[model samples]
Target: MAATLDWKLVVDTHDAPALADFWAAALGYEVEDNSALIDRLMTAGQLPEAAVAEHNGTRIFRGFAAVRHPDDPYDEETGIGRGRRILFQDVPEPKTAKNRLHLDVHAGPDAREATVARLESLGATRVEEVNKGPAGHWWVMRDPEGNEFCVA
Candidate 1:
């Protein structure tokens, strides 16, 4: 039988922590805290001091950070989400093309405008308004790092 597997969406960013923070607020999720694990790894000489950095007084992997659903289960030792999550990893290259995959946030009909405005305040830029008449309506938006997503 095919087995179900836990998974997370990974996003490439120039600044992992900042992108993670933005997504966490945008999605009403919580930033994962993996400081304890980092500390243990560093003490064991497994991870180098240069591999980590301080964020909000906690140590995070220099090139990675993540956000998780607030009500989801997670590994206490590693701070890894077992349910819904988004992992951000740093990449040296800038975004060069439109995304083939993107997130569509559902805010329903009445709240679309308000939701779009809120997202804009959170560092997302409005790319365009997409109106499908009877099918649906949404706003194409770009995150701080220029990743595309929609608010519908």
Candidate 2:
């Protein structure tokens, strides 16, 4: 038998919190809140105040944020998701090329347009449309920071 390992998708972004919020809303996920852990670290004099910041009234790590499936199990003490998560980490460089890998969101047959529209309202830009005959169609879209994802 093979050993099982857990994993998460991590994206580099100029603004971790913003990207985390955008993805959380887009995927119906919840933003992971690490305030309790940060507070504990600070109280123990192990973390500096400059290492955290207030985002939307929540204190989060300065260069990282994450979102997880709302129903996924998570650690109560640290708010770290144990399953189905995406972590956004701050990068000094800007995104200048197409993503090598991208996410595909399925919205069934009738909800594609509405789903795309909703995503647009949340800062996604339509890049183009893809049609594969019998394979069906999907919209190629870019997130606020230019990462591409598809809605089908």
lDDT by residue for model 1 (16-100), tens: 9999999999999999999989999999999999999988888999999999998788899999888889999999999999999
lDDT of candidate model 2 versus the reference: 0.93
Relative to the true structure, candidate 1 reaches a TM of 0.95
TM-scores, all candidates, are 0.95, 0.95
Cα lDDT tens digits for candidate 2, 1-152:
54324469999999999999999999999999999999999999999999999899999999899999887789999999888899999999989888999999999779999999999999999999999979989999999999999999
Candidate 1 at 35: error in angstroms? 0.2
